[model samples]
Target: MKVNYTGFQASEVSPYLEVHQALKAADHRNGKPDVLAYTSVARMNPYQALLYRSFPDHGFAVAPLLKPFELRDLMLHKSRASSITLHLHWVNWVLAGEPDAQRAQTKVSGILGRIDRFKQLGGKLVWTAHNVYPHDAAHLEAELALQQGIADRSDVIHTMAASTTAALAEYTNVDAQKVLVAPHPHYRGAYEDVTSRAEARAVLGIDDDETVFLVFGALKEYKGLLRTLEAFDQLLDQDPSGRYRLLVAGGADDHPDVQEFISRGLLHDRVLMEPSKIPGSKAQYFLRAADAGLVTYTRSLNSGAALLYQSFGLPVLATDTPVLRETLPPHTALFLDANAAVDEYAAQLKALRALARSTTQTDVLDGIAHLDPSAVSSTFAQDLRSRLGLRQH
Candidate 1:
């Protein structure tokens, strides 16, 4: 079965890359989905010199989604072109408040009308719920309307987690039977170990023995950077000589909380922030250099970062939120109740740092082996085939 994925942006850092990579790998493996096409909403508009670049090969006919009329014509005649299997990566524009919401909704409604026609033409619709509902109140009504529109048009809906699926079902027009929870496909790059404890420290310009706690990703409000800083400060008071350094590797310029952390003397050189995106390969270096990975998301669904840490065997110290509890074992790394005392949180981090050195590194690496690319890609392919009414073999 051939498949076409429609998303806001297919090549950017979001989970759409996971969809592209998984589909590409599946095509290589089973040689089914005979064809895969990727259309990006951003690509439809002319923009240039964006700081980020797209992955050159996603094994799909990548294109810009043209105007509403063009989209209708394309979908209406997709059989002469390729099979239409719409995957809704995001519905932000269709849900309003974004730039040109009126125009975007007009275009999207035309496409939805075309999708209804596609079903009559024997096309399949698989809408992936990257977000169940927009969190902001301003977007609530528009989001619900878009949800109902997709529900009315789609043959099935796929969500990354059961929790997300359940949340999505609260919206009208979503048939509970049509939603399936598929875990986000795991991602693995070639395993590159830190050169050495000393060498890893040298690369990051830190002392070999300094205790490091790593925080990865663009600093977002609910990600709990402030809480993480507070915890780190508490840890420092216990042992000022502990030399606990927080190597913050990700874009942080947009977050005022980060600057607040710096200006308030909560962090000095101990808190390092990367103003740009880091290459995938060098990710492990930061992971390995740190004593443990830190995730203080006061609010989150699930973190690919936490999974990445788990895969590398780097123990995670995260708030005991629904998503965190699902992925991590209690005390294997450290899990603190969101309301836990700062001292309690500090103690957990302190213990992990001490125990981390003596813990078998191979154990951590071995655990992550389950998250290897081949396993995730295979699972993704089987699911895609099943959704497309094609036999995997």
Candidate 2:
């Protein structure tokens, strides 16, 4: 089958790379619903090349998609099968043009119309609910309208966490029956030449005895980076002689709060900040250097960072959200209320630091065996074939 996946490129920060790689791996063994990637451009990003280099024999192929106007023309003139076999659109990235309200509305309306038309032409529409709404939504109502329209039109609405199904239905009024819950796959062998924990810590200038807590991934307003900083500061105050360090790694957003925090000179010495896009080869260095990963999101539907941390057999200190609670095992992760006081968060950090000192890597992996990438990929392939009425080869 010719599956056209939108909002996917080889070098995206989202789950597209992992999901596609897993599906490609699975399809090699169990050939069902043969898939090909659809991109707007021909060139692969450097990071994409790094990730795909090892899978040289992987059967996936990348082809260009019809341009916006060309897509409209095809929907009007061509048969559904000729136009495309299956359309799998992801996240709010596909719903572009947000600043100009009129333009955004027109684009959204056109896309929704195309979705309806695509279905009418016997093509399938799949929308993966990466978030309840766009994180950087400029035009709120227009974005929500587009989400609702997509939810209303999609043949299948995919969410990583089961808890997100009800939240998505509530937000977009999508039917519960239309939602398919599939857990995000683990990052087993995504990176190359990963650094050892000791080597990583040494290179980062962290001492062997220092307890490092990492806030990995893109630093955004909703991620509670400031709160994590506050809690870490309080922890330092409480234990003046403690060897605790904070590693805030990943891209920094243009949010005023984030910029303000950066300008305050808080990230120095013990607080190391790498405000850049971490390459796939260097991802393991960050993960290995830290004793535990922090997910202090003020709000979230699901956190891919948490899964990445867990996949490395690293313990996580996460804010208590319904989605995190549902997805992470209680024994492996330490959770606190989203609105917990700084002192309370400080205490939890102290506790996690002590726990991390004694916890073995194997202990962290014991409870999350189901998050294995192979299992997740098989499930994803099976679900797609089942929903699209395609036979398993």
Candidate 3:
């Protein structure tokens, strides 16, 4: 049996092959796809999927880079590396969840070796610098080694913020010549935004007058979920009216402290805790219910979650990081000192009690139309094709 996938094809079904791979077994005539996006998302997550959505239109085949983090299979099939471009995004998967520095080094070393060999085979690589280090911020040596090695080899170091080059230069080697600044897409059309605010709040048991402060995305420490929780605790202690409702929802992490803190937060009447990945169909419920997005990232090169908030027309309460300041317009968000005290956080929350979003959803979208995913990805694909000297469609 044969099936077509996004105009790419599979001659026979194979569980191991990505959408780009055909299961004919012997004919390696068309091996791996032309563009492989390595990501932190699930195999078909919108983050990576939407990125290359315009690729097919631009005459390129795309697929998620499958596991084992090596190109040995391509080598085994005698595939030419010149035909492929590996796009890396938040590649902490190379750490393999090993906290120990020694084991971490071994894992990173293996992947680096494979990348080196891929380059040797005439492959070009594009690395999107999503973070300076992994969320846990562990194993400085191994992380730095991996990034420095990649920076030296990457044909383009893509980033969502202009500050990426300077921010990364503080800790790792960054060749400015290799840097390319692009926009992070707002998840406007990605989520099912079917529910109205009233209906969402009603289902979620939120009160009409209460202002919901949403802390979304995975509960990683680097994202400042714990700090957000701590401020909510202080806010509760100081205010009796409880107008500020804390809505913490997302895929929870396995870290003991994070799990414990979020667990404690669930007990509070003012706190609404989903503590799991919200289904795409239900993503709008939280966004529509909340008035302001809470981003307490201690460090970040860029934030898709922030863009996600603005996509739904909600303003954000974010740490005043350089990247956020540069990427987001001032009208779309209220900034907080990144290194402020818990008291300062509580005060900020107090100040936000009656705050209203200055910009409507339309205005938010209009301000950055140039950065819209459709345009940005199309430009990216066309530019990529030009860089490779591929024929223009």
lDDT of each: 0.57, 0.67, 0.72
Residue 300 in model 3: shift from native, Å?
A: 2.0
Encode model 1's per-residue lDDT on 343-392: one tens digit a residue. 88788889878767765656666655544454544554455656666443
Residue 16 local lDDT, model 2? 36
Put down candidate 2 lDDT per residue, 27-57, tens digits, no spaces: 3443332342232232312322222232213
TM-score of each: 0.72, 0.81, 0.87
lDDT, candidate 3, 37-135, per-residue tens: 343445324776667667766655554455536454444323422255667777777875686989888887888899888778766688888887766
Clash count per candidate: 0, 0, 0
The order of the candidates by lDDT, greatest first, is 3, 2, 1
Error of 2 at 210 (Å): 0.6
- Return the top candidate by lDDT: 3
Candidate 1 residue spans exceeding 4 A from truth: 1-77, 80-82, 91-122, 131-140, 144-152, 167-176, 190-194, 253-255, 262-267, 329-331, 339-341, 391-393
Residue 35 error, candidate 1, Å? 4.0
Best by TM-score: 3
